[model samples]
Target chain A: MSSLKKSFNVRCRDFIHAGEASISVQQLLKQMHIDPVLIRRIAICGYEGEMNVVMHGGDGIYCVEINTDRIVLDISDKGPGIADIAKAMEKGFSTASDEYREMGFGAGMGLPNMKKNADEMIVESEPGCGTRVRMSFIIKQSTPT
Target chain B: MVPEYISFVEKFCTGCSQCVRVCPTKTIRIRNNKAVFFDELCIGCGECTRVCPEGAVSSSISVIEPCMKDKLNVVIVSPVLYAQFPGVMPSDVLIGLNEMGFDHAIDLSYYLEMFQYAVDEFVLENRKSNNAPWPLISPICPVVIRLIVLNYPNLLDHILPLRRPVSLLGDEIREKLSHEHGVDKKDIIIYHITPCHAKVVPDRSGLMDELGFIDRALGINRIYPGLKQKLEQVKELELSLFPNEHFSFVPSTRGPLWGMSGGEIAGMRIDNVIAVSGVKETMAYLEKIEMGLFSDMEYIEFRACTEGCLGGPLTAVDRYMAKSTVQKFIKMFGIGRRLPRHKIRQLYDKGWFFSRIKPSELAGVYKSKRKPLTFDDMKKIEKLMSLIHGSDCGACGAPDCKTFAEDVVTEAADLKACFKMKE
Candidate 1:
């Protein structure tokens, strides 16, 4: 039942530092002897989630919890929350602006890509309060061929 | 052939560990007050050749001699040769090479045009094939191919199984000359004049083995002095005729551009191609590819040098200036010639484009095992990590604090080794 945890502060609109948190998490996962395939899933999920925070969220905190059995990521932001959760979760649905798109991101695929990579995803939001996303990945019994 | 393309000249080596710090593969190590290079771990990227301030590192190439009188020597020149001098054209360089003892000199761009057609058809067919891997990596750069085979063996199938243009050209020239001159193939020695040190390495094993026709590699820098002298001697000759083109040796518009960075991607006609150059950047990109981060990409062109072949450590010209010179050549006479697509397809179907990259013995040797730290070991490492400043200053001789902590656990070093902590 022992667990290891780390938290990273992600500032909104910090485009330069957008992928820094995900890269840091990736290095940490590699150091922890996690399966490479599992690490990749976490990296993609962490990256998409981190980018969402940088592009849309106000100041936010990205946290990670890992144990022998599973890995979890908790991303919470103080930004305006989505009104239609179903629509936001749609594959091509995006609220990101043209400026973000110009930076080769915000293709409306972040949330869906995150969902595809993670084993399970939970989203909670309030209209003007904030948005929080928790993603969980189960440790696989064997490496996928 | 020498076992290694690069070696440490111990007389000048100061054991500064600069090469170890920059090596992507961690092949260089400080041992007994000198640098020891592990050939098995080296990818031959020439990063060590560039970083060695004491001139301790030398890239070995076969020396050219006019004394090999029994054999007809033909030099296959890279486009980087044209980029070397300010006003010199590729034609001038080739003519000078001829004056310097070569029976004839030809450009690799000629074969590159043929190669591009092969690539276009391969990509189109590969998409429809049942199990062909997407994001086919270009195998043009030997160093990049070696890096993948040695480090990312899983992506080995992803590489385009096409013989390098230079090697393909060797086969072509040897065959054509044997028929045209009524000479034996062995009597015709085809030398590749290259800017890259990696190009000189004869494949003893692995994917690029059995390129027997490519007799030797002569470095552009090694031949610079002799070529310069020949250039002076050939100053009165008409350089505009393009002698090689008269013999049907010419390249397409994009052929010469392959010598510069981003050129291969520009030539790839496919969308979502990732072109990366320089050792460190290519290493990072390869890691991403290994992680499946670039699954959406259709192709990747990885070059070890900063600006492709033009930025190779064995080059005589500055990379920036060389790139501009190549661009100027493209503007004037770049559209030399191209074989028709049908003709190229015929060659492709004949299996001329096919090549193999065998897995390296070093592949997965270091990465397959994921060493899980015990609870006690983690606690010990955490304690050691906490005692030092978190800044990743390399004063401890390790790359960073985490590696330092890992070294402490492995009993390779101690905490007092951190000079920053001592301060």
Candidate 2:
């Protein structure tokens, strides 16, 4: 089966345009007549990843791949990478500054929420290097009502 | 079958594509030098009717004389109807309807009070139990509900499941008037005096069609001339002539305000309610809600009309003037009656106010049968997008270049329709 791939850029500290990428992806999925439940889950993951990049990571790239069987999202940021991925994955363990926390951006639940929504998630990071997050959502095959 | 509330008169349409630009759902397209309406995509916000400069888009106004002659006609006056005539009070409008050859006229504000109470209770209980979706949406506007059904299906569970005040009032009038007048249930016809065209479709189709509460809807503008004359006559009468009991019952302070934006939430005791009006604003807010935003809000009231029902397409006067009139009437009437908490609770317990609106029922009969786009289709659309100017000029009939490209790729439109491409 043929797959459609799309990419969006997320700039660090650009609060005004942070959610633009996720919203565009959501609209695209809606136009394709994807199941709303699946679209919403994917949107939440996209938004969380986008926000995380803006709040903590450097300028990032968010990409999505869609096919009949499943949809996948890949997000990478060119920022100071996480030193301990295991501790960062834990809920409420945030490295965000006081300013970001005050703005309600760095809630430390980003990775956990993304993991909950995605069928499979893989995070690759190294100190002094950038971070990459990959998430996949299985599309249920059903007759369109 | 979905009732055709809004119709396009081809003779009057100049193919300027004005209606196409304002359509919220992008359902209207210029085809064969005329605008074609796709009924399935329509949410009946009446935006097209409002924007059509040539008056080509007309809302269907039923001829009520036949029903009046055959049945015991009872007119349910919308609060917006009272607001139309500047100096006319709600009671005056009711009297005017009676003078204009109606068996009885009921004030919608009375039921609106009960509707408010029911919603308040529903929100409170839902908050305590955490059983349903948070930030429950108001069910007052039929167009808003239809919008959710068509574009925001994921937010369906957020809609408050309650019958409109008009339906509640219609049910009571039909049941009581038929018995009191010794007429058959079918012999008693209830007509809703509506200010909006969107209200016309729900009575005959959609989730409330099976209830059959409202027999027909009379647009305010259609009946305004005769009703205004009747109200003028009522205005000339002495103020003290009517007996004390006749003017004893009045709607609550906040009920009449339901004709304007932010009125529904004003009546509720809850503090976390947000009221949004206008079709575009409502759609944007719904999109935000779908993205899991606004979690703290307990309720949201959305009106498809810009300034609420006062700004309805069928309104007789300016929306601002109508709003001022309603406000003046409210102030003069002196914060009218309030339903007792016990009474409201009893009705709530009996399930008198609840409406069973299934998701399937809200999904209109004409569900779009278009297949989901494949990767190849997407590629074709992208290619078409690159070939055309993205200025979003309505000369191509579609709202924007993206929609035009999609239409062309889907074979719904000819690629040559793009004026830029021809050049």
Candidate 3:
């Protein structure tokens, strides 16, 4: 098989289970016996995406595709999209309300952290049309078994 | 290596997956109408033994026989044994242990007290350096150590590297007995009387191999009948062997407390500590620690058994009664110290209280063992998963629907095994 995909539903402001999706994805990759380094990257970026959906998105779907050579994460949400993707991509530029701040999150590091951790990142948003963030990580070349 | 303390009896197992569901490591799986164990992944926590309705799981506890010519037998009693028999005096147990044909029976409470001191000093040293990871995890529970070594390698650095109290006591007793008897060190056999099954696994480090300090570890359940008989004998004779310091090491007031949950932290006098018991709760705590949730915490004590060592599968008494008995015993005698802090400090500074284990090297092997899921297999698994009812009811002899689906796709299970599918 070329690839396998799994999708998770992220409800907005569900702080009770904020990182549940990322954990599930992480566990799945672990069960697959992926390299620890790759699993760590996936966990960090996936959790950042999951937290973003719970904190900012009205509703979202987090999809992970695992391929022989690479893994892909696509986070799409129905919410007030970022008008200036460039500005929101900067570190410490979050627009989170006081409640989010009180929960020790929304420091504006989510997008930047994801971008820094992933091999490549893509962002698209239409202010009111919602936003979609996609990230791809190259599976490190392995010595042939 | 994963220890072989807990054995699965295939004949008695019904493939209920009760042990599978309760296994924190997910090492037990149902295949061919039987529960199979991945020994490398098992931590020997005895959770399987606890949940096996068919009585299929049993632990390999040590059984000490009488010493032959030139062999010196010494029994190192578990601190938890004091809590095993209700209304039984601590001295009575020691006397009973002696009556079992062992030359000497030593209480571990003294070693436990020393261990507490060592722990406090180690934590304080870490606090001063501020270099080690936060929330230093306790390594007293062999099962917890195995869990971390197998599953949580990253947190290995956070585990306090001290040797178990019993190991230290084993070393000391062997040396003392050999010297006093003018006998070869090999002639002295030290057997640890234990309440936990995990203790039966030999400490296979080079030092342990060389010294053979603790030759065997026997569960209290194995000796409880003999001990009960001995206790009756002592009561009938009205033996006046209280504080048998001449015959054996009397436990200091605080060490036996290590038998219960939170006892280690309380004994160490640590200010900020979180004590969690039971395999599930310990695993959850570990996950949270992995997520950096307990960064502000100082210490975490994770015991595999529900009520700590007292709740071990090999333990003879109910956990609550044991806890109360321990408390009452401590109250009746009150607290006393066998050695001064300065002496404990001397031992700590001499580096005699810690394990020489290179945790990363030893535990690092358990990683990279997860089987890779092929893309074709993944698709089939996903398709099968989607077709199944998502209740995760575990009625199909697998832990959940997803696992059952995977098993079916892999030809390890049949599709008709699903009740919903039959409907």
lDDT of each: 0.74, 0.79, 0.77
Q: Candidate 1's residue-wise lDDT over B236-263, tens digit each?
A: 8766556554243543446558888877
lDDT of each residue in B1-423, candidate 3, tens digit only: 224777657799888778878877766777677887667777778887877889887786646465564688888888888887778777777877767677788887777788888888877887889876788888788788778777766677778777777777777777877788888888878777778877647532222121356777778788788788888887777766653443366565465678789888877666878899998889877766765556677889889999898898888888998899888877877766566998888989999887887454564654435456666767888888778847988767777788788778767678888888887
Quick one: best lDDT, which candidate? 2
Candidate 3: which docking quality band?
A: acceptable
Question: Per-residue lDDT for A50 in model 3?
Answer: 82
Give candidate 3's total backbone clashes. Answer: 0
For model 3, state the Cα shift of residue B260 in Å: 1.6
DockQ, per-model, please? Answer: 0.23, 0.51, 0.37
Q: What ranges in model 2 sit over 4 Å off? A: A95-105, A143-145, B1-3, B62-70, B202-205, B209-211, B239-249, B329-337, B360-366
- Among the numbered candidates, top TM-score falls to 2
Candidate 1 similarity to native, TM-score: 0.84
In angstroms, the error of model 1 at A50 is: 1.5
Report the C-alpha lDDT of model 2 over B174-250, residue by residue, as the tens digit: 77777777889998877878887877565422654424888778888888888888777878864442212322234
The local lDDT score (0 to 100) that residue B381 gets in candidate 2 is 84
